[model samples]
Target: MIRFENVSVTYDGAYEPAVQDIDFTVPEGELTLLVGPSGTGKSTVLGAVSGLVPHFTGGTLRGRVTVAGRDTRTHKPRELADVVGTVGQDPLSHFVTDTVEDELAYGMESLGLAPDVMRRRVEETLDLLGLNELRDRPIATLSGGQQQRVAIGSVLTPHPKVLVLDEPTSALDPAAAEEVLAVLQRLVHDLGTTVLMAEHRLERVVHYADRVVLLPSSGARPVLGTPPEVMAVSPVYPPVVDLGRLAGWSPLPLTIRDARRSAGELRERLADIAPVNGRLPHGDTSPRKDPNPRPEVPAPRRFLRRRTTRTAPDTSTPHPAAAVTALAVHRDRVEALRHVELTVTPGETVALMGRNGAGKSTLLAALVGLVEPTRGSVRVGGAVPHRAAPRDLVQRVGLVPQEPRDLLYADTVAAECAAADRDAGAAEGSCRALVSELLPGVGDDTHPRDLSEGQRLALALAVVLTARPPLLLLDEPTRGLDYAAKARLVSILRALAAEGHAIVLATHDVELAAEIAHRVVVLADGEVVADGPTADVVVASPSFAPQVTKVLAPQRWLTVSQVREALSS
Candidate 1:
């Protein structure tokens, strides 16, 4: 249904093509997954399928891209709307209506479909995506994950023959992601719909793909094969495949069930050697305690004083980096968070996890002073966040929000890094160094807006770390990052925590939590449903466990790194 013949794309800039000599064919009624590292033109390839590459994006296409026998070169996106539906990474940019129901119906209305048909399709999409309760909610009031579902449903309602998605499940929780993927599976199997998706979170979608197309690196030719064939040689793969490689299993397993079937002997090998706890090593930082400590301050003071004036190296009796007691926040008459209590000490990492709109992002907002608590108190670095002065707050805490572009205002990346250094009172090139470390090959002259989603996230993170705040907050830190980039990020964050910085990240990436988080705090319906050690919280819950933990069940293993450590010792 989709064919690319010697395709190459180059923007107006003076450089080589973004994608070079990309040729592939995706059969009708099959799901094709596009895999690659950041900035390898996965998005560009998807845009070509929808005719957005050279048409709306102001790029030059050298070859042919056809969808459903319609040449994209001749057919613009609007002309092909009847047969093609495209959903990009940023869902907020795709909406034209105010509410969920309206957004879903907007596409059909544009297509001039009958009102009755449109209504029926809209209801079906809402139920398929589990957006029934949110159908009346405003798009602005919904969470990031909810917005992603609405974006997908808007495209799905049109009943197009082809669906082109970019990071479709990046923002969704595990269960929601599975629901969306299952719906795509039904479309492929029952309705003969075609799907071409590009995603960074391979663990969630690799096994669901009918075929795999890999763009190994920038300007490299594409490699197409079955999932196992491609994953055997592909640079990026999920943890289950990684375990299969480590155990020397033939035909690397793509799913947990396959891995578990071959794990009987491996389980016995690890039975005597307990899996290493995936936490900060003891003696690396301060003495640890339960994350849910009793409240030390009774009232919220505008200018609360620091508990101790000693430096970061002074770990004896160190105060909490951030404290929340009976915290509550209400937005648009909805209780976003209610009576949430938590504490984070210096040199600690915590992950806030839950379903879409379950108060994880809201809690992070309260910590960084973006949202005022309806009740209770929030203290970060010994000062009330909402009332603290801007200058003081910069030194106390820094937040990398869900939308990375929100933190970038400069025209070029170089200018943004310079501005961050000056604002943070840091030496020149500090931000640039962090950027290079996190995401290599990002040029100084490039526009921040032109960077890929993962690249933008890295720039935002570097800007925040330039200030060296005692407390750091990240929302969906690994949204666009591949395994290599995520590993660099884990190394950086671990080093920061060792230097006495407290980290709290709100994310749905269970593999990431399993890798770096010392604690996992699960939220539900604006309340704290569960909070405990990473291994304890994720392993016990079927919804949040990583691939390795699920494969090696009855054993408390959480990550491939832990298993590798145990095997090496």
Candidate 2:
């Protein structure tokens, strides 16, 4: 359905082409996954499919890109709207209307479909994406995952033959991501729709792809093959694929079920091996007690505890780094969080995880003073965060929000880095150096708005880390990051934690929690449902468990590296 023939895209003012001589064909009625590391032109390739690369993006397209036999070179995006539906990385930019129902129908109205057809498609899309309850809700008020589903529903209502999606599941939780992928599967199988998608969360979509297109590097040729054929040598892959490689499994299992089937012997080999930090195997799933002998703080007055943990007392008392006592936050009559008691000391890494709309983001915002608690107090470095001045907040805490664009404003990446250094009063080029280490190969002259979702996130993270605040907060930090970039972030955050930086990250990336989180805090309906050590929390919660944990369950392994180490020893 979509074809790229000797295509190369060179953006204006770019030192080299974004991509070179990319030749591939996404067969009709199939889901094709385009994957590569950060800044490797995956987005550029997706843009070519929808005629946005050289047309709207102000780049030069040298060769041919045809979707449904219509040449993108000759037809602009609007002209191909009936045949192609493109969803960019940022969902906020994709919406033209405010309400969920209106956004879904907007595309059909633009296509001039009959009233009956538009109405029918709108209802069908709402049901298909499981957005029935949210049809009347405002788009801006929805959570990141809900907004993502709405963005996709808007395009699917148009009934285009080809769908080009960039990071469709980055903001979605695992279950929600599965729902979206299942919708795509139905579209391809039931209706023969063609899909060309670029995503960094390969673990969620790699198993469902009909074929894989890999762009290994900038200006490099593409590799096209079956999922395993490409994943065996691909640098970016899911943890399960890594496990298959570690065990030398043939044909490289793509799904967890396949990996589990082949892991019986390996499981037996590591049956006696213990998980890190004394996490029991398939037994004793309760919250682990605090290891320190410090006294526990009582819940604040007038607060009813829904769930509570015994937070370790501040050994270096008189001033705890960060603390939330009986915190309650209400938004639009909805209790986003209630009676939450939490504390973070110097050199601690805490991960907040839960389902969609679980108040994870709200909690992170409260820490950085973006959201004020309706009751109780939130103190960071001995100052109330919501009342602290912006300049003062920057010194005590820094928050990298879910939307990376919020923190980026400069036209060029270099300018943004320079501004970060200036704002944080850091040494010149410090932010630039961090960005280089986090995301290599991205040109300094490139616009931050033009970067892929993961690259933009790296830039935002670098901006936040420039200040080196005593406490740091990240909301969905690994939303669009591939495994390698995620590893780099894990290393950086681990170093920061070791350097006495208290870190709190609200995330849905279970594998990431397994990597760097010293403790896991699960939130539900604005309440802390579970808080414990990482191994105990994740191993008990099957839905939140990492792939290696699932495959080797009953044994309490949390990551592929853990299993690899146990085997090697």
Candidate 3:
């Protein structure tokens, strides 16, 4: 369906080419996964096929990129529309229409199809993507999963032979992501549409991928092979894959279930050896909880509540938390939330999970009236969000948007945090101390923009956390952050939860969600479909649950802590 022959992409800026001497092929009717760390130009590959690299983004391109035998250089996005469908990481930024049906019909209409032809295709797509019930719903009012499906539906209507997705599941909760993946799987199997996708959450799609390709961060060449082969060689990998690498398991397990099925021998041997806790006993991880000095031989941290030592809580009524009831309202056309009921209690961390365009961000924005709901109410810490003064909201609610850069504008890291402190009516001088404590080496002299994405994320997190708000909301804090950075963010959030603060995190990254959230909430089409303690919510729905949770389902382990608990039991 597509081919890249000795393709090298050089941007207009004075830097080296993003991709150098890359040669690859996407076989017709096959599903190919492009995996890599941030800035590896996985998206750039997609852009080349969609004609976005040279046609839209300024760049000097060498070699050839052809889609369905048509060279992209000779065809623009519009010309390739009939042969290709592309979806990016951020769904909100890609929308063109205001309602669900209209949004899905956009591409068909643009192609100047007959009215009857457009109507039939629209109806088929709505049902195909499970968006029928949301057909009349406003595009902005739909959840992240709903919106992303609409985005896919819009493109699929063109009957394109190829579909290119750039982290399509990056923002979705496990369940919604599963739904989207299931739809794509069906498309590839039933309709024979070839798929070329770039994604960060590999575990979710790894099992289904026909082939996995790893892009080198050094811009040298792309590594191509089977899932296990590619993952074994890539420095950037999921924990289980890393475990498989270390265990010397021949024909390494691709899924946790695969690991579990063959883990009896390892488990029997390791059980006699003693529990491996705290951090993976023998892996690449710094001391997350303990600082100053690292431990050589680490045992997994003991679960505070051991399954064998405790009894299940009374299953009569749900525990009511002291969380906010959010009313989501955004821009003029987008009403992401409508009188939605949600809450967070003291000593609890609630994970917000859904697809890219789901109301998660809008819900986070609504919690503090950033984008106030047009009709309903939002209450934080017993008071309505709109009722609180701007300064009061700053003191009570701290938000870290998906792109941390949005929250940072100061020339220096210290100054950015100082601004946050100023909003809290606290001493500006304390910002430097707080930021330095959270992010070592951060100072008033380091330009915030010049720092790496991980550093910038940490800086933004420090700025928000300095306020020490009673209610904190974070939107995709894991984006662009390395594993260590992810661990640090998780540790700080855990500490805050222990200190009697309520936290809500919106993320598509499952392993991080598994590590942090005390409770998990699954959102679909702007409705609360599942809610409970971390284990219950994540395990209750297999399709929507994270792969880690799914693999240990019925055994019921949500995190490493729980895994330890299960072993002890």
Q: Could you say which candidate leads in lDDT?
A: 1
Order of models, best lDDT first? 1, 2, 3
**Residue 263 CA displacement from its true place in model 3, Å:** 2.6
Write one digit per residue (lDDT tens) for candidate 3, span 368-473.
Answer: 7666567666677656676778777776778888777788988877678668778766665555655665667655777876565566777777677666676778
Q: Could you tell me how far off, in angstroms, the CA of residue 414 lies in candidate 3 after the best superposition? A: 9.4
lDDT of each: 0.87, 0.83, 0.70
Supply the global lDDT for candidate 2: 0.83
Model 2 vs. true fold: TM: 0.90
Error of 1 at 352 (Å): 0.4
Model 3 compared with the native: what TM-score?
Answer: 0.76
After superposition, candidate 3 runs with Cα above 4 Å error? 267-347, 352-366, 370-384, 401-463, 479-485, 495-501, 507-510, 521-533, 536-546, 552-556, 559-569
lDDT of 2 by residue, 213-243 (tens): 9998745688899999999989999999999
Query: For residues 359-449, could you state the per-residue lDDT of candidate 1 as single tens digits?
Result: 9999999999989999999999789989988777887899999999999999999999999998887788878877776667888988999
State each candidate's clash count. 0, 0, 15
- How many pairs in model 2 have backbone atoms within 3 A of each other, for residues 3 or more apart or on separate chains, i.e. clashes? 0
In terms of lDDT, the poorest run of 10 residues in model 2 is: 292-301
Each candidate structure's TM-score, on Cα atoms with residue i matched to residue i, is 0.94, 0.90, 0.76
